[model samples]
Target: MVIGPDGCGFDMRSPSEMEADDARREADEAAHAPRMAVTSRIRRVAQPPDGYLPLSLFDEVRLADPVPLYAFEDVPADVTGLAVDYLSRVARGVPARDAFRVPLAGARLVGRSADAERLLAMVDGFSDRSVRAACLLCGFDAASRRGPARWRAGRVIDPGPATVYNVRRMVARTLRFMDRVGPVVWEGFTFDGGYTDRVTSGDGDLLTADGLWDLKVSRWPPNPTYTLQLLVYWRLGLHSTHPEYLRVRRLGLYNARSDTMWSVPAARIGADAVRAVERDVIGYADGL
Candidate 1:
């Protein structure tokens, strides 16, 4: 299900059709709407009297859509903490570290988001094996097979999709998933229209600055790459699909099992990290 050539869905045909369709769509979109980047910077009009939206109103938008493609893993607060610890170790370059003996209990959320209840619910349903699964989904063979328990030396990890892999293809799915996060619902902030989901722009849940939060459940070593993934989703509002929708002032990672969490400004995490990952992924596709 590749979107049109330019990463917009109006052109729903296959890759071959993308080039010409993209041209036409770009022209039409150009005349009708501004570039996503520019449009996003313009900011959406503040809604409601106080420049804020209520929790229940946001629920209606959540209900409008039949399915949410972006994954919201329901993992325990404790397990998330463990992931954080494990990440710290990996980042420190303790190649031989093992995660099996580490217990998952102390993971605490450092910040909160608008979808707090739903996010917590999702984490409740999440499994510790998710990272491994992501590797598999990317079409690679991985062996270290890390879990909530231990790490291994000489573990053959999958680098993920090769060059020649379709950039437009792989990223579109990821981008669309990134696009659906609701507007910032924390009462103090407001949004512009650049954001939208399958239903409508500004339709989903809004996390007031207080509402935006993330939980990490770990099994393997820490990865700067992993942290950056979180930053990218937060900082750019997953590509700045809408204005002020994800104005994240406070973001953090919780280590559930250990009752530990680290909160930081989105900028402190370094914006280029995710872009670097994106670049590598694209390079993989090119090699393919």
Candidate 2:
């Protein structure tokens, strides 16, 4: 039973309708609210990393785009990224099956969760086979809300062989890197709206023993947008009630596709730059 969006009660709108809706939403929020995600404020703030940091971390930029370790025939980067992230959590200490409960619950709510569970049961451990299953599961989870309505119906999802092939390879590279890192002090942690109510919620990937880290499973290099997002996450951590972030002294990015890492010391990010983001980008009130 392939469920269409209609079957799942998801609102189906044409591109124009969606665009108009977005325009209206933006217009309504324009006066009182700022952009919510850290990504939104990056270019708008116009605060380049060079404006804030003394040294460039990605100085030895790979001129050549990295050759993929495995062929991703049909899998999107989003599903692959989630699979790698989930596998990383499993590599640390999270139970493999349990980690997917929330996403799976969405399927369960619509009586489709059993199919995913049965499919996942074929793999017993964190093998390449398991990676493939995780990828499919992530795909199904992504599709549940975002995909066409028919996809949401009681359908058995096949994340495709390419997802298993590519994500397995990516996870192998990522695990090797993750093993060398310190213990995870934080995982998928979100922040309080300390600076602005308009920007309500955001989360960081990992705060390991060494520093704060963001995982990038994409083909792109670390641009200014990526750099600013990390900076925002770190600053948000400091502003939040969590005192543990005070001990974090570095920001890092791990590119799973290229098996590479880039980082900058938190100390290099000047206080004035951070203050500017708070005041300008994130809309912090004076003396707050």
Candidate 3:
């Protein structure tokens, strides 16, 4: 019924609007007029956790990791998510309402991988435009009118295999360059509303050696807006589990096509940035 922020993807059925739309469709089908369809822009509202601050340059765009300082202050777990939940249903090969009954084996489920896989699994739940939305959300593809949506088992799913391969290759190269990368702890994960599915911790999500590592995926590239995202997860572990923030304090960003992993310093990240994110978490808790 209701589409994304943009109000397209549905047949306009108001008597006047439908008449116009149908006439346009018929004209196109009959080669009487150039094919025409209505498209409307969706207005975006700026909203984030109090402590986290806005991720965009100002208000023109959104951030990558809105979660870094998002305290979930007033956000209901169900604040807004149905497409994502549907994808999880398809990916796990189970109904969304049903509990995940399958057992885990050697799967390193969590973080980016889980998001990507869930997108892979859920095909039917999305409309044509929604697929594009997911790709943009994951940084795999930009929202373009052209290009066929890569369907996964008949769903409009395409996780840009080319980009995924690129990420894999870069990580391997980084490991070779450093020569002492830590064993990735696949700490068993569950989808826990990071995007509709809640991925539980302790199960191995992907981690770099010593908790700091480089992520080189064919993505839109992480920016300051999204960096706090990694920071939040990092803080989760830092504040709760590790606390010492030891042995790991770096992140490298590699373009999906590029070879070099640009190392990031966990310690070197500015205090203001850290404070901004901390404020997000605290603000949520404090209900600010």
Candidate 4:
């Protein structure tokens, strides 16, 4: 069940209460918008450490990529999630099972929102039980779905106990990869801060002293959209929040499946390219 802000129990708001809550949240956000913008501007003017570019160049930048698997991997992973659904069909060469079972493998590979959070906590020296708890939660969530069995894309199939065992193995591999990478300043950091007033806000999987890294659980190198995502995070971090904490020199994508890392200097993401990304993203959002 969905938890509420107080965490005393599950969310149980009535329709009217939910609407009122939404309205209040919007109002509070509107009230804070000006202050946030001013803070962002002040941060931009501050000089970065040696070898780092100023944040001003990215103020007008926007992301051009669509909300596909490669582009939005920072979102919670699920078996039936967009990324897993695509991977199951194209990469895994496995016929799709019911929607509920689709996310079992992908969630283990990439992780769901709770899984990411728990992993971050684990890296911070929290108990290993957090990882096990996350795995169990995912499995429980999958098994709890109450719907008639349905085929995916006209493919009829069933995921058996072996599938569950495979998910556990994948989780162990993922955890091992994280251990190799070591600790970071932040993980699963969403630059948005739950406010959508500006274009800079987005997700950055990990933040380090030198750069922002996006974790990829894919076999291939990250695509252009993934590169663009790092650029966006760098831009957002530069202009907003603790600028000193975000004085990153580069952007990186870590391929967890391959245990490989790829990075480039942040300065190489030119203004012209950012402008193009901005145009495309704005245009797409407008169309939507």
Off by over 4 Å in 2: 1-35, 39-68, 105-124, 127-129, 140-157, 192-195, 286-288
Candidate 2, run of 10 with poorest lDDT: 57-66
Which residue window of length 10 is worst by lDDT in model 1?
A: 101-110
Question: Highest lDDT, which number?
Answer: 2
Q: What is the lDDT of residue 33 in candidate 1?
A: 51
Residue-by-residue lDDT tens digits, candidate 3, 160-192: 443323223333343443343445432222213
* TM-score for each predicted model, relative to the true structure: 0.27, 0.69, 0.35, 0.41
Q: In lDDT terms, how accurate is model 1?
A: 0.31
Model 4, 210-282: lDDT tens per residue? 6676666554555545555565555555544555335677667665335456767766666655554333332
Candidate 1, residue 87: how far the Cα is off, in Å = 25
In the range 1-288, model 2's lDDT, one tens digit per residue, is 245766765456788998999999876776666445564455566655464433375333232235566544466676678778877777666776766654475566556678679756754556656766776676565444333342444333456666566766776777666666667777776676454554555566788875888888888877767777787787777778887787887888888887778877776666777787666666666412
CA lDDT of each candidate? 0.31, 0.66, 0.34, 0.42
Query: Model 1: per-residue lDDT, tens digit, 209-278?
Result: 4334333334332244334333333433544445444455645443222223344544443334434333
Error of 3 at 129 (Å): 29
Better of 1 and 3 by lDDT: 3
Per-residue lDDT of 173 in model 1: 26
Which stretches of candidate 3 lie above 4 Å from their native place? 1-153, 156-211, 242-245, 254-256, 281-288
